[model samples]
Target chain A: LAKTTQPISMDSYEGQEVNITCSHNNIATNDYITWYQQFPSQGPRFIIQGYKTKVTNEVASLFIPADRKSSTLSLPRVSLSDTAVYYCLVGAFHSGGYQKVTFGIGTKLQVIP
Target chain B: SAVISQKPSRDICQRGTSLTIQCQVDSQVTMMFWYRQQPGQSLTLIATANQGSEATYESGFVIDKFPISRPNLTFSTLTVSNMSPEDSSIYLCSATGLAGQETQYFGPGTRLLVL
Candidate 1:
């Protein structure tokens, strides 16, 4: 499994866009970048996933660099409820099974009113 | 996406006691996982419950301490044996769909407080 590093914390005002980046210097060839959000007293919720380039969904967007060494999760028009810890994971895809990825210290985003 | 549920949302147990957490999924899943999260910390995977076989535990975790049972595809159990104050933490259950499914869903978690 590839190790990931992210900022310890970030602050953003409501209605502003927040971008959290994660770096995986030794990302594998078959690795896919995924992000998750976790609120207090709740399980982590899947946000967005991407292999390369940009992938957007209704909730968030993921941008990956050409080298696949890093990825960023962008949350648009953040609200107070969006304040949560975000985790970035790099999972290696196997032929017939799922590989577990380790969780690192996530980026805590606080949305201020 | 899979919907996962765990039994005994929270419990306070005395030292040397044991607590078994039950995890149920709304649909059949191919992979089931157990995790521990200490207060103000990130999640650490405890083990993977493999159906019809023994569970695979991660380093620093053992079956004697954290025994897991996955009888089928929809349900599993994890028992924290001989609890102590240091064992107090939130236990979470996670699952993934059939083969090739990348998304993993999680349960609300069972809060265990050992006194």
Candidate 2:
């Protein structure tokens, strides 16, 4: 399992783009960077995932550099409902076996009005 | 993504009591896990519910306290034994390995409040 570090908290205004970065300097060859969003009183929801370069979904986008040591989750047009804690995880998932996922403190993004 | 559901959405139990949480998935999944989230904190994985075998617990968690049962591919149960005030937290169930999807899908958590 790879350890990940992220900013403790960030603030963004409504309708602005929010980019939350996570660092995993020891990321392995098979590791994939994934992001999740958790609102109050709810379970964490998957946002986006990427191994390298960029991967976009209906909800968010993930950007990974060539080194694969870090990844960023970009949420476009933030709203108050998007204010939540975001978690970045690195693991070798869907390998036909059990993969252990570790969750960091996460970046609490507060979408201000 | 799989649609997961948990029983007893919220409960308030007395000290020394026990609470069992049941997790059901709409589709068969290859992996299921139990996690704990204290108030205003991140999630901590308690164990992996392995079908047809005993669950694999993480460090700082024990089967004696957090016993888990995965009888099949789509259903599992977790029991929080001998609860205390400190044991109050949200228990979440998650699953993965559904078809071509690689990310895990989570269920609405069971909120346990030990008094």
lDDT of 2 at B36: 96
What are the candidates' C-alpha RMSDs?
A: 1.2, 1.2
The lDDT of each candidate is 0.91, 0.92
In model 1, the runs with Cα more than 4 Å from the true position are: A95-97, B98-100
lDDT of 2 by residue, B27-102 (tens): 9888899999998999999998988999989999999999999999999999999999999999999998777565
Estimate, for each residue in A3-47, the C-alpha lDDT of model 2 and write its tens digit.
999999999999999999999999999888889999998999988
Candidate 2 residue spans exceeding 4 A from truth: none
* Tens digit of per-residue lDDT, candidate 1, span B38-75: 97799999998999999999999999999999999999
lDDT of 1 by residue, A15-109 (tens): 99999999999999988898989999988888888899999999999999899999999999999999999999988755425657888989999
Determine which window of 10 residues in candidate 2 chain A has minimal summed lDDT.
A92-101
Q: What is the Cα-based lDDT of residue B111 in candidate 1?
A: 95
